[model samples]
Target chain A: MTNEKNKKVVIVDYAMGNIFSVKLACQKVGICAIVSNDKKEISNASALILPGVGAFADAMATLEKLDLVRTIKEFIASGRPFLGICLGMQLLMSESEEFGLHKGLDIIKGRVVKFPAVNDKVPQVGWNQITKPSYSNINWEETLLKGLSEKDFMYFVHSFYVLPNNNNIVVSETNYAGLNYCSSLREKNIYACQFHPEKSGESGLLIYRNFYNLINK
Target chain B: MKNIRIIPRLDIKGPNLVKGIHLEGLRVLGSPEDFAEHYYNAGADELIYMDVVASLYGRNGLMDIIEKTAKKIFIPLTVGGGLRTLEDIKNVLRAGADKVSLNTIAIKNPNIILEASRRFGSSTIVVSIEAIKQNDGKYMAFIENARESTGVEVFSWAKKVEELGAGEILLTSVNNEGTGSGYDIELTRKVSELVSIPVIANGGAGELEDVVNVIKQGKADAVSLASMVHYDYVKKSMVNGSLLKNQAEGNIDFLKFGKISEKIETSGIEEIKFYLKDKGINCRK
Candidate 1:
């Protein structure tokens, strides 16, 4: 609103946490981001960020209470830009098993689950590489992975993920147990990732930058 | 292609990072936020915060710390320790932590991992396994070291973790803890072969050579080290040298773990090292 040339990208902070980083990340890309739990602020914004950092079910409850689920869906449907991070990303799915049968935004026909514990250790902590050459094209289209390469590394810290019922939603993938699992996902106007672009350093910032650019129009 | 991961681990207690020898009597080392920012700048792909005092506190106080660090550090931060149930995982995730890691509880109820993954998807759940080579020379599961034996083969249980919907494995070797003898290559190798998910090798990493050796022998996707990397004890030059040697020999490829660009050269490694150090991160050296 202040700078006509600057795009307005509102970070939908429903007390879901990670509001600050998501906001800062967007700012790094020169996007004028306003962190708000307000529906009006969200509705007026050219772009929306549903930043989430908690359980899938609880996050959904919060979104529902804020009457954001419908608004978010409307934005996506209207071809406006939207991005979901971590738990926010998980909520875009149909449902998650976090607290027993919790429903999701259902924009993408998928489910979220906790990371399985192999005999080794649970919570595959720390940095690991993500790869699957075939997914390079669709994934690159995702603003979150912009300015990165096919083998580019993004930071991850999740116990659950979005399982696209439709593989076309899978933009990029990273292997964990020799199996290629969807990492970043895209569907028309909406985008999401199981990994955190906020914490992925420069590459992560680029993702925010690209997502921000989507709203410039 | 095997993805290569370099992770830095931080054991947090009350917003501060405390690294102890063998997960006991943690000493106040530095700020978790600063350390995380440092590592993120140091080319560390992801960082883990193990709540070493979850048992004493009766809960995982990861949210406050997670939100604090996530604000300053833009990379992924994982929280583990003292998780009682799936609800606990939700609480931490709500608190701004990226993922929830469960260990002791997973041993008590493996279905928790299965249930969470079945509903939420598998990539979010991480199961940490504490393995000890028993007197019989066979690996057995432990919660906080060999305190309570699960009487299960480490590698066998690793397979179970994957089946239960775990996204990745955090493998720590009790025999290697505090010893600085390098990683438990055999344990890493065995688990790597057992599960197809990414495996993170923790517990013992004395130097840059140890880091390279662990990934090479174990075929692990990532190497997670705490004190060695966090305290600046491991020299950045060594890490650069090691990575260069590995790359030159074709021992590893850049894209295995996801590189923004594979522009790193044996010679360029030094330049990147300086970039990281200038950013105030604690590296392997």
Candidate 2:
């Protein structure tokens, strides 16, 4: 991996996400990240990171109002490294059923749904372990799951889980009170996860390092 | 299974970190950022900075402290005390607080909770209820750092706050606070059961057993501690009104507030987590 100086990563600011922590995480890994709502800065980024926290419908509305929908699509189509975290990841789905039926960015073939009321809490707050598949067509070892194990814990605080249309895109899964759900997904240059790697301590910092390495390569 | 959150709650008075017995007779500890750094290194799951005098003093003074600490501490930080408006919430969030806990303003204007939650996510908003056990054996909510009683029942208020879109409920027992007695198990259990959102039991935690009891028996998703962790590291730190006089006399420099000593023999968060884990509590190792 190249330790390129002044490597710029753009965090798409639609005015909803936890952009502070994400930018700090990038700084921890020696990458300079700029949180920009401007389309030009986003399109010109070496790598794009979309970090979001809040309701899915409200986020979509902000993105629509800011007119970032097409710019994001074209950036992803360019095959540059891109990452979506938490609500940012949820917005990649075709639609979400949070509160009511609302549309998403549709970068990935999936729909966001609320966690089933199965005797457990609605929002699975706190640290939970992620399980990787034994075998898969995608190189799980080479992707964002690099240098990590199944027992590694990630911080998650959300009531909804994603159901992707294709299983091949799923890189890992986590089980919450007997209900297994998709935790991380990857499609070509795009990467997304339901968990917050920025808030997950040292193990989390490794994921950002891996992403930086991928972009640098 | 979800891991239980272990939070070190630091009560701040202006720049110095202070703790009181049942929220009175405030004693000055050193800088909050120092204690925050110590806790972060000790493997604390999260940290809470409560401006104890914010409501009474009419200003939240932890913005600069939070901004400095958030740069170093990567864990989630929840800031509470005197957050009365949407602009206040926005300012705290901009200063790098992961979540803002509302107590006085939430009870005064319930719409602030709705508006804050609507603007920021529900997860970013927490309703901190200071509960005191009444003579009839039921808990009543208090405000202004447990000085005034709202007379609203704990269970009903918790449900209402959840309905108002609070992501979590921080239930503190004023009767049990700083006394090292124990957390109010019955109150925590009732509030936790009444709401689908997470409930954090704060106030009294003297021993590992107190932490275990609150989570295992009381069903608290998280625990916020002050005296349990604070007293462990400082010597003769408990102040009874006279320290405030010394502070006001300009004889005491808060930077060199108290002598450092280890009163509690445990190895901090690691030991606590290990003790809890041995007792079959699933905590993050």
Candidate 3:
């Protein structure tokens, strides 16, 4: 039986990230999300969404200052559905090379790295297609990208990308300026992507809908 | 190849969305929220909201409009004008803007570009350059609604901003802005070639071919349009009367009485994308 206890989706707000847009995206999909850094509120959430857009070191510093680093790690460890977008996804890595070398939450045993010097721009801004990974047997229908078509367009604005230690976690990959990289990943209860699904239009909304459905189920 | 983004730029005055020629002689279109929502639904790759008078008046008031639009529109929103400090950029981003464009202050004090890019991430900081082709064929950067000249050359400024860690550059050709003639190909090409960061070519998209030429010849990573798409959206809204709302803002008289001339050749976002695709130019589909 679904009750109020089972419906809470907490968007961890540690004074960074586009919290409003994430909250509004949830609202559009009929999931009321509370943007908070409160330990109790976040720990008690049925589902947690970690959304951010900024430097990795600064984001990690702020999360540490707000005392949310441990709270978030614990929340993910609890096996409740966890979602991370953009920088939030990168934070799941063990470390990132942005600005200077810095450690991450190490939730997924991955490393965040910058796009190698290429003919294209640094931050792969605007809409780019995400294709299902060929190496992984993971089905899109069983993850956050459940209803998205193969090679569907999603909005992206980032300078760095994540490299998971294990390929099994990666759900989708995107090609940018000849650099085919991991775009999204699904690992047990953890869902993360380098693109901002909230700003990805109809296909993006579907991602939120899928996450919402996952929470209730 | 990365898809070329087709961005619809809306210039705002007070409460209404306005359009002007060469960034002057403002004419109110309608509510920006209406246009933003229309473009978002119509499949715009991205949307740029420029507060034209915000810098001149010494205040930035797009927070409310951004908040209201961000509630419904599920696309990246770039807010520009009068963002003089990191606090202003932070507040706007908090209000739901994915990126903040700095023009006047970026030229006045270039250090802010470095500071903002570092603090907010380079991708979140966009440096918009308003360029006017001078007699010597050199593009000179302008500020304060193109009323004041910064006396700096556009090419150098583009490189400097990139060196300062700016993720992208919004290069608007004052010579071609709102004229519906075409983009300044030479100017766009020079800037795009000078910087590694993505350059969004703004102003002078009179037709679909103009859009294609800018990307193919000019090498612009994206195109920012105002008159071409704004007029088309306004014209269509006139027929359906769907974009009009009761709340009054800016100059609503255009929506009330003004008529879009037949000579105002325009194209929708989808049509532009289709045309770009037909020409073998990859755009958002």
Candidate 4:
């Protein structure tokens, strides 16, 4: 029964970003994920990886083409766990300027914007610290962030960041250039991160293990 | 300002650090644990450990090896070689590696980039490509010890890697490695420009000047070298010495501050003109 509960995870692939790593990540935890763009598959799967990468407008356009917006809203409404990665996390925003006007899932009210910087280094590269997590008792320390050191350094390579409308959704943060950088967030069943825990080594791997445990719950 | 990394590469077979005298080569240097501590003490930015041929042997990572490396080294470490599926990546990550890289598998199945990125996180996945310039003037991405070619163009493939959720691109130039000629400048810049993520240059590097030149002229974010650091004729300490000696005279005292201040203070960077006056190192910018 526990194995059955862990069996189904759908990697929503609308051709917007890479959904393979997420699927593989799940597979590592003994779960075989179904990569799908179909509404029925997404809604039916026990868990989902709403993975996205590339320009926000393009991601929105693809989701619209697949008629995914409604299905995602419908699926999330079902209270199943959904995980979004970098751009995956960004697409949950209400709007973005990655090309032109675009709308996101709005599950967490917010907008995604290109990183504010004085230089043309739009994409902040390499590793940095992820420090501030909004909720202290959300099992984050015991789960996703388990093996990581407090203020554990994780890998980051992005030019845009999200501003969640409801501050309560934020789980943790990092900093770059003396500016407060938001790195991770959690709102109910939806969890996200702007940094790569998978690449973060042991601390990062522990985070994945925790996520697996989360969806199983 | 993001920190410009100073890192070292350590190749571990079972327990000791191995240095290759030539390509596909091998020779035990010393305890990897010892070298890792030495590099950390020397102010290296991060560390990378390549299993070399562990996967081909049907061997899993040595837990003792990982524990030793993780316990002694305080910096980030990316482990690569023979990573075929998400499970493989996960096992490595679970053992406490900072990032997992895919090379040969990614060429055969480009989707591996996305799968790993999703399961772990985008920033946790790195696409380590072994590229060689072809007679036709196109750079080709190879896999399985360069036995197979993806038939995909390097620049196009770089874009695909990013699109698929790869956190960064680790590019090694086969033509330039061991020669100390220099990195493939045009190829490095072109790929870096095409991808949104940081591009690391590898293969050819002889001295400290080569590292600076790779970044300045090649427009790369960072460069990686092995023989350059592990050889008898050359060493990491020698390179740093040369880098320090190459600096302009007068602000000689500035060299003493690197340990306490990993980076120059923002205020000092602001009053650059005055600071330069102190060092007397002339700069147009």
lDDT of 1 by residue, B1-285 (tens): 233556778887765566655565455554566667767666666679888767776453457677667666666567898888777876776566666678889998899998776544566577898888878778888885346777778878999999878888889897776456778999889998888777888977765566667766777767787766654622333344332332322212221332211211121223333533455432322
True contacts kept of 3: 0.67
**Over the stretch A119-162, how does candidate 4's per-residue lDDT look in tens digits?**
33457765667765544444456435555655665656677889
Better of 1 and 2 by DockQ: 2
Preferred candidate (lDDT higher): 1 or 2: 2
- Per-candidate TM-scores read 0.65, 0.92, 0.94, 0.56
- Expressed as tens digits, the lDDT of each residue in A102-189 for candidate 3 is 9999888979988877767777888899997878677888889988998899989887899999998889999986778999998888
RMSD of each: 10.6, 4.0, 2.3, 12.1
DockQ of each: 0.22, 0.67, 0.65, 0.10
Candidate 1 lDDT over A1-217, as tens digits, reads 3466786778887765557667767766788888887777777788888776555766677788888877787778878788888778888888888758888888889888765554433344434445544734454654456567766766665657778888876777776533467777778888877677776777778787777666664
Comparison by DockQ, 1 against 3, better one: 3
Question: Which number leads on TM-score?
Answer: 3
* Model 1 spans with C-alpha error above 4 angstroms: A1-45, A49-79, A83-152, A155-196, A213-217, B58-62, B233-285
The DockQ score of candidate 3 comes to 0.65
Tell me which of candidates 1 and 3 scores higher on lDDT: 3
Stronger candidate by lDDT (2 vs 4): 2
Best by DockQ: 2
N/CA/C clash count, model 4: 21
TM-score of chain A of each: 0.90, 0.95, 0.96, 0.88
